[model samples]
Target chain A: MNAAVTATRGATALDIAAIRRDFPILHQSVNGKPLVYLDNAASSQRPKSVIEAVSRYYEHDHANVHRGVHTLSQRATDAYEGARETIRRFINARDTKEIVFTRGTTEAVNLVAQSFARPGFQPGDEILISALEHHANIVPWQLLREQVGAVLKVIPISEQGEVDFVEFEKLIGPRTRLLALAHVSNALGTIVPVEKFIKVAKQHGVPVLLDGAQAIPHTPVDVQALGCDFYCFSSHKMLGPTGMGVLYGRKELLEAMPPWQGGGDMILSVSFEKTTFNQLPWKFEAGTPHIAGAIGLAAAIDYLETIGMERIAAYEHELLEYATDRLSRVPGLRIVGTAANKAAVVSFTLEGIHPHDIGTILDTEGVAIRTGHHCAMPVMEFFNIPATARASMSFYNTREEIDRLAAALEHTRKVLG
Target chain B: MDLKDLYRDVIVDHNRHPRNFGKLEPADVHADGHNPLCGDRLTMYANLEGEHIKDVKFEGSGCAISVASASLLTEAVKGKSKSEVKELFDDVHALLTQHDAAVDPARLGKLAALSGVREFPARVKCASLCWHTLNAALDRAAEPVSTE
Candidate 1:
């Protein structure tokens, strides 16, 4: 468990050496260079503990949940349900009934759109979202808009990439049926002050859905504290397994809405005439869930809990600052998203070289980064760029990695020069 | 593999100064090429002189691989017939995608520089976008050919 050589240490840092060692994938080489994974925003590498948890579940406790009376089924059900409780506690949601296991953030948004918002939405009812939303947040609403004739409105962002709170105030009128926004812009790393937006939405009697796919990994998220009606996040973005996510809807809201999908576990009892649905969360969880994925997520949460989200957040803020400063020094480089508040993502463009070229050169250096629109084409459209090379960070990443990224950019300049 | 293998001097030169890098108006054959993965957009125009390419031009924006490939395609296909160009496309496609594909120096000419794309599997589409679009143009298809 070698601590990666970092140039500086944050005052409230987790021992990054110990953190990096927990994830075995970081020890590998790419193109003969140590792998510098800066694509956490896309997907994170799983730690050994989380990996083993999935293996352990499949090896010893593999069974269909909430059905079989066998010990394995009971064990699987307990572990899966226990994961829900753990997530409820993690986000400080009031009850486990409020947490619905979704396939991922996309599914969670679709669930809300189909189950929650679709039922109540009237023709020309406006669904308000910020300009900074990822495709996951934007496209689902667009689909609902197309389906129900709901008007989709965007809260504009500033040049610095902050949500225009004044514009948001004007946009939250009576016809605004729901407000969905990115908690943090995945493309730009702009941390929208969602709390302020939520407050305004509440006064307008509009429910808020925060796309927490990017936010949950880097920061502490308390659904109660945030006071958003629904907070959707993916597990893979938070070091859990892919295809696993949690939708934290308010309890009364969950109780009131009809389930999006109906199948085996979601039903109370079925007959030729009629079938009563299951209560609360299980009603939305239609089929046999990702049993092992839930257990792996719980293990991931345990690992994050051990590190503590606040400590991780604090350390990552420092990492962001260091990365920003280091990356800004590269000639002809312009940081695309320059919000005062950002996650550990640094999206940038070189003056002459296309981001694709930068990405290619960086790959040669084993510095993996996200290139192109990053599923936020509107954000790129707003910025007047075709694409950017985004180097998003995580708790396990180091200053040395940022240094490597900068050095690679310098090499990229030389190579493309 | 070396980055030099991917970004050879010839590739970089073509990228910097793409030949026939604009629209050919009132053309007999025209088609657009799009690689949606990287947002590479290319509009290709060809003036056909009884199936022999009289003139060819392109206008668009993309990465080095894409731009250079388009530039090289315009130069290589001018005097060649549509059938010859189609065969050239097959040869260039193989050269770009297959690591073990042999390059016939005389046939490929400067277009042989595209053989570097074989080292970058992700970039094979970028190098062949113009070829696909040109093939579509040859068939008189109006739809934009996409390298997805």
Candidate 2:
């Protein structure tokens, strides 16, 4: 395959300087030095459009959405519903009803655990999740296992951090009710072959819920093409506002499942004796939602749309390669995940030196990085390390920033030694 | 002088050549403490002479702050009574946590070098996890000796 093929007519480099200008926080200092914010996996810094959209909603369109006869209500409802449509188009979902807004990815997973998995789960029914899952993906299924007598099966990964497909296939049986996995690993940055995995799960008559929390921000995601039953992702991780997230479920599946929560907006009618439920989306979105959050997310989607996801992904891929090569040359340094298909996250450990020490020294030089298990303790256990120093990147990250990181790591080795 | 003045040559020397940094066989008390937040792990062994800590040895993985703090702690507690060690630990902890830059320097000894850590609040765990675990180990021994 021509891996180094020239860009096609449609392919263009992302204007990062122009893009960087959209995000105000990118220009700042930390620890008396310029901040190189590489911790995008934890959460992304919001663009000005997203930030302004949120403020605008609260300033101008501040009212309860859905069923208000007033103009402000209609305006608020339009903005909120408009945000839903933006995400629906972004993920390429079939209908707006499939995109149910939730607090974030954690709530989205819990919604599925409570509404879908909890009701049908029985003894011998297995829930297969990868070793690279964040605690959000792990704990909800654990709670469901305790509640519904379901068994939690782990899909192991190779030392290089790619999910062991053969082992994953072996774990999948007729008993597997669900295959919940991160689309892109929060710790390792291994972008799993999710579309293929979804197809395999479908063959087994099992549903797949992708934790697209990391994937959506970095790459293009199409629910229709992936053919997954559900996809969940947090807006905050995608340069949007914090409190909002999207859960894309197949319409038939969502309609069949009972509502996870009961409140005003979710119900069609209620009496002391009985209660009736509303339609999809609203049925899942109970009470007053994060109005400004939805507005902000829509603006974030617009920002990504303007830049183009493919260009962003390609740029980040280049940055990842540059960073990997740079970090690999450092003596006594070992890269944790070397999966062929990965995002821009590079997790590594220095020989005989603790990650905390690495993080502290780097911070002293004005480079901020995340150091620890990264909330994926199983991945840490897999590597047999207590923790790792992770430098996650986004479209904003540059090769120069990566050089800064490399220089800081070298300085750390000298200082700590 | 600012707290950065606290990172004196003495502190760096102790951090580089940590005192009593080895395992004690047949140790009277052995305990391990980990700061899960930062992933610093420390294992400490103490040979008790009745209520007094005859010897305290430490081995683990951590940042310079934690290793240095542990080294300073070992030096301060040697030859002191168990009660004196407890009192000294309290005094050192209070000194580190104090917001006032004018904390009396006489009480902290070489441990005073960590006053710089207070400026970087995030590293407080790196500086204190070992000390907190030492207190836990001592309390667990419970021969009229409270570690905290």
Best by DockQ: 1
Q: Which stretches of candidate 2 lie over 4 Å from their true place?
A: A1-10, B1-16, B101-104, B143-148
The DockQ-based CAPRI class assigned to model 2 is acceptable
Among all windows of ten consecutive residues in candidate 1 chain A, which has the lowest summed lDDT? A1-10
For each candidate in the order shown, give its overall lDDT on alpha carbons: 0.90, 0.85
Among the numbered candidates, top TM-score falls to: 1
In order, the TM-score of chain B in each prediction is 0.92, 0.84
For every model in order, the TM-score on chain A comes to 0.98, 0.96
Output the lDDT of residue A384, model 1: 85
Task: Report the backbone clash tally of model 1.
Answer: 1
RMSD of 1: 2.9
lDDT of 2 at A249: 98
The alpha-carbon lDDT assigned to residue A401 of candidate 1 equals 86
lDDT by residue for model 1 (B1-148), tens: 7899888898898888999999888887888988776878899998877768899999998999999999999999998898899899889988987778876868899998888788888899889899999888888733455769
Interface RMSD (Å), each candidate? 0.9, 3.7
